[model samples]
Every structure is written in structure tokens, then in C-alpha cells.
Target: MIGRIMKIVSRQYTLLGENGEKHDAILMGKVRRQDVPAAGDLAEAEYVNGRWVIQKILPRRNRLIRPSCANIDQALIVMSVKDPDFSPALVDRISMLIMKADITPVLIITKCDLGIPDETEEMIREYENGPMKVIRTAKDEASDEVAAILEGKISVLTGQSGAGKSTLLNTLEPSFHLATQEISKALGRGKHTTRHNELHSVAGGLVADTPGFSSLDFSHVSASELGSCVPDFIPYLGKCRFNDCIHQNEPGCAVKEAVESGSVPQRRYRNYLGVLEIIQNRKEKYL
Candidate 1:
């Protein structure tokens, strides 16, 4: 029978059967010979030796390389207001990656108790005005803001480790004993305790506590497709004077002009240029 793979604890997996009975399953040889199963995978298994043995893994709609999850519907880009502080470029980079992967991006700002600085608030509004949904979250477990923001979505909670990704997940669902680390005082970077991408079942949805990566590199994508990855740049894409305009110093560039006109945020354009430069530098490598 086919079942949805829920929690993968070591070699054992908790499978939610079609009838809703949870079964503890292990990977059969046939399954292990193919692809390894993730938490969100739809798998075929059988009851053998008093335990379910997963035999096959179904195809995934989409997969994220870093988080190592398949069939994700959206991403929760968590950022903190203090400690390591919030970086809008990091948010923009992740948002661009989601856009390229055809997934929804939700901006979740945590550590609101430290006061939402003006720059952070403006950054949140800039993204909210774009294609992303922006919401605020606190360290408090009872805060309904993050819970309401996460309703009914297969969202991946991602950010720098010290940014409170695991803390927020624990707050969202207290049952998940996801280990969290404190920020390093000397380095000012998050000490990552999350080692793998594990999915936790939440009310009306599933949230994946993804392993954090310090840096995001989008140089693999082609330069021609880079402009479209920026959601705000979509409106002025085709309106450019030249079909191959990179929007840097090009005359009659709608995107740059919009930034000057306050239509698009200056930071977003700067990040775009930064990404464009990376793409251009890595252009020959990808080809």
C-alpha cells in the first residue's frame, strides 16, 4: 500500500497509511537500491516481519538541494532583529532562489521583542509589497502571528541557525524537540545545531526544519534568466529598450529607473546587480 512518509528517525520512518494508521517502517532493499526517502515523500510499502518496509518512493514535484526536501510548497525565510541581525540581501537571495524554483517565499521576522528597527520594517514592507508575504514573530510560544502565517502550507523554515529557526519551530509545535543553539559571542554568527532536513507535522500544515547554510550562491543560474528571478523586476522586464539589457548602466532601463522613482527598493536593485555580477562571472562555467 502507498503511504505518506512523515518522520524519518534514523533508519526507521513513521508512515501515515491511507487509512490514517501510523506505521513504523524501514527501507526495504528495493527502496534503498533506488533513491533515499525523505520525510515528505509518498512511498509504497508493505507490512512484513511485523513492521512496514518501504518498497518504492514516488516522484517529487520539486526538490531543494540545500534543504534536501522534495515537493515543497513554500519557504519561511526567518530573520532575527538582533543577535546576528537581519540581512536584507540574504532575504533577497533566498527569495530569488524560491522564485527560480517556482516556490512561494514567506518572509518571517523573528525576535520582534528587540524592537523592529526602521530598516528592517522597511525591508519587510518592500518584500510584502512584492510577491512575498511578510509577517512578524516573537520568541513567545503563544504568539499567533507566525502560526497564522504558516497555516495550511508545506513550508520550510530556513535562515541562519542563530536566527532562531528551530526556536520558532519549537514555539509553533512544542512537541518537536528540535535542538537549538545560542549565538556565538565572539564570531557573531549562529551556531548551527540542525544537521538535517526533518519535517514536522503542524496543525493544518507541515514545517521542515532545514539545515542552515552560511552562504547562498546563485551563480549556477544563467544571466538571461536572472532578471526574472527578481519578482519586482517582472513588471519592467520586456519594457527595456534592448532585449539583452542587464539593467546596469543601460540607457532607458525601466528597472533601474523604477528604483530611482521609488517603485522598486534600492536594496533590491543592488542585490540584483550583485547577483548579476555573480552570474556573469560564472557564465562560462555553467555553459
Candidate 2:
């Protein structure tokens, strides 16, 4: 009668029932109007008239925007050093978004066998040295770094396509065998392989491999609220000269001073400023 929707495809969901029978279910009207029933959703369903129909969707602990998944424990952000390359700004923004949503963010740098780009290495050190945890993964290696990071967690994989998110998942659980794509030669990017967000069982955890993007819009986060998203800035937030410090060029600003004194990663501060500008120009968009 009740089950969790494991996967949704062609308007049909694969529901794992309490009785342990996985059935193909169609959504009823009331259930469809409530919210998108993402994978891992505890839902009410029934086999009526010889067809399964989802009847209800339970509340979610958290939801990711682009991927549109719910009840996430944390997120693993994959970035490559070569092929499609890496973007530190994108990494910082996504990491900040995770923190703002009260979800832990773990950084995974892939393609380590090919070696890391200078800027990519710098970003890795920045994350590892600061409040966030970082891990480096390589192809064809027996490194369980990603699995160790995701142990007992419902972690989502996000990055530019070809950043090796799927590859990392395959390494974690060889049986998953999710589709992966090669970088485009003409466009110098990766072709999309993951079509929709679906949960895959990993080593003692679940992972969502979603479509990659060139960049993510932070229009949902505000300028003032943006500083709080950077976990390292919390300690110096109230110590500023003015309570309304935006941490820019404000007089007696502790955040800016920390940036200058190497307390916070300079690149992170720069990324924060860039986000601040975007948030300022489009303040209402975020609010």
C-alpha cells in the first residue's frame, strides 16, 4: 500500500512497496498536484485495478535546485583538471549553496592521474585548508576516496559534464554502470549522458548523477545573506566595525582584513565579491 518511489520514468514510477514488490506506478491526481515525487520519496501508493498509482508524497528534509532531488544528506562536487577542465568560481558557488541549505559539501577533484592544473590545485588546497573537506580521485585507481566521503550519506554528484561524476560513482560501486560520456571535440565540452535525476545505490549510500552545466545561476541567494554562506566568514561576522558590513571595502571590516592576512582564501573572497555584485544587481530575483 505504501512505498518509496525509487525512480520515475515516462510518467511511471518504480515503487518499492512495504511488501517488497517493486511495481510500476502511475501518479494519481492529488499526488501529482502536491509536488514532484523525486527518488527516495516515501510515498503512499496502491495496486488498484491491477495498476499501481502513487497517492501521496511525504515531506522532504532538503531539495537541490538544478538536479531537483530531495532529502539530501550532503553533496559531492566533482571537477576535472583536464579534458573539460575545472572552474573554481563554479565550485565555490555550489559549495556556498550547499552550506546555505545546511547540507555538507565535499569537494572531489578528478583526473589526478593526468595531474592537476595550477589553479585547480590551488582550489583544492583552499577547500581542504578551510572549513570544507576535499578529496582527490583518479581514474583506473583503487582509491575509495569518494566512497569514504559518502559513507552512510545520501550524497548528490554535481559538476560540469565530463568532470567524472559518473566515473567516480562507477568506481564506488562497479555494479551501478551509469552511462558516461566523452568530452566533445568540436565544442570542447562534455556531451550530456545523465538525462534525469535518479538515485543509485552506492557503497552504504545513495548518489544522484545529474546533468552538468557550464555554470549555475546564484540568483536565488541575496548579497547580504551571501557572506553567511561562506562558512569561514562566520567567525568574523559580528566583529566588524559596522553591524551592516557587507565585507567589501567597508571601514574596519574584519572579513576584508582576513582576506588580506591570508586567513581566508583570496580567491574565495574574490568569488564572494563577484557573487555579491551579481546578487546586488538582481536583489529582487533572490528575495
Candidate 3:
């Protein structure tokens, strides 16, 4: 029988079978020695004796390392405009990672009731014109627009610790009852409330609320692959003067020209450079 893994707690996997039955399956020795199945993975299971066992994990369309989920269609990147303050660099970095994994990225701007900064609003507009879809929401207000986005899609919801990801999830579906923590005023960050990733049925789709991170490190990505991750640079990828242009300090670079001519958001370009530097530094250290 084939089933989708709904949740993985410790070594036990709760799989939703094709017949709508739920099975508590353990990994077979062969699967254990090869690859472990994550939440959202479709696996072949068999009833051995009186217990069900996962025999094989099918191929995944995409996977997220931080969340440890598989076959995600898109990512709902929840960000706060106030409270924790908006971090465009963080959003860009996450979006880059999602795109690199061949998944769509959606920006969810929360806390609009608290009033968004002019600069942040402008940045939102820039992203709207770019590749990803952007949505704005506030506390206690339910958004059908958000529901539409999640419908029939496997989405990974993630963001900074204090960015209201849990609150937004509750607002979207009160039944989730996901734990949430208050932002420490002294430290200006919220405690990690989500420790594991679990897939939940929501709005005709499966959504995984993953643990929040204060910062993201792109150690897995190489310096040469960095430019391909940024969506804004896609149009001018091979148009640069040098075929191997990394878009920084390179003469006749189309991406740099776009930033200078006000086509690409300067802030996005700046963050790209910042991430590129990190990747380059990591490469140098390893060498």
C-alpha cells in the first residue's frame, strides 16, 4: 500500500493511507539504512505480521532542509512589518532558497494593523512586480485571499521567530492550536515555540508549520550558484558582459545596471551581494 506521511514524531511515522485510513508505521530495515521518510513523503508501506512498515520512500519533487519536509509546492514566508520589524534581506534569502529548490515563494506581510513603514511598503510593491506573489494581513483578521493561495498546494510556512507565523496560522485555522510565544521586549525576539514540522490539512491543501529561525545560513549554496537563486537577476542572467559574471564589481553587468537604473530593487541587490559574500567566504574557508 502507498501512503503519505502526515507527521513524524521520533522514530514513528503517522501515514495517511490512500483509503483514508491512518497507519502507525515503522521504517523497515532497508529504508532505515537508506533514506528516512519525512512529513509529506509518499512511501510504500506493507503490513508485516500485525504491524505496518514503510518499505520505500518515493522520489520527492522538492525538499526543505530547515523544515525537513518533502514535496512542497510553495512557501508562505510570514514577515512582520513592526514588532520584530521587517527584514527584507531575510525574506530574499528564504525566497532564494525556495526557488533554488524549485518551489514557488509567496510573501505574507503580517501586522499591517500596526502600520507599515513607508520604505517597507515600497519594498513590498517592488516584490509584487517581481516573481513572487505578495499578500498583506493583520492580527485577528481572517483573509480569504490567503486561503486561496494555500488551496490545493503543499506549503511550508516559515519566518523569523517573532514574525507572528504561529499567530497567523491560528488566525487562518483556529483548530491548529499551534503554540506561540511573546516577543521578549528586552531581546526583541520571540522564543522558539515550534520545535518540529507537522503537515496539517488546511484550505484544501497540506501546510507544514515549521520551526522559526532568527537567522539563515546559506552554507549549502556555492558562490557560483548564488546568482541563479535570486529571481530578480533571472532576466539578465547570460546578458552580462562576462558569461560568468557574479553581478558584483563586474563591468557591463546587466544586473548591476538594472539596480542602477532603478529596475531591480537596490535593497534586493544589496542583500544578494551580502549573501554572495557569505557564500564566497565559506568557499574560501573550505578551500
Per TM-score, the best of the predicted structures is 3
Which pairs of residues collide in candidate 1?
Answer: none
Residue by residue across 197-283, what tens digits does model 3's lDDT show? Answer: 788878777888875323476767777778888888888899999998899898999999999998888999999999998888888
The TM-score between candidate 3 and the true structure equals 0.91
- State the lDDT of candidate 2 residue by residue for 1-287, as single tens digits: 77766678879888766665688889998778868778877778777899987888888888666676777888787888778777788888887888777788877888989987677677678878888777887887646766676676677777877788888878777776776774234445446667676777677666778763335677677667788888778788888898888998789999999998999988889998988888787865546
Clashes of each: 0, 0, 0
In terms of lDDT, the poorest run of 10 residues in model 1 is: 182-191
- Candidate 1 Cα deviation (angstroms), residue 188: 15
- RMSD of each candidate relative to the true structure: 3.2, 3.2, 2.7
Q: Could you estimate the TM-score for every candidate?
A: 0.87, 0.87, 0.91
Off by over 4 Å in 2: 17-21, 117-119, 183-190, 212-215, 284-287
Alpha-carbon lDDT, every model: 0.78, 0.77, 0.83
Give the residue spans of candidate 3 off by over 4 A.
Answer: 182-190, 212-215
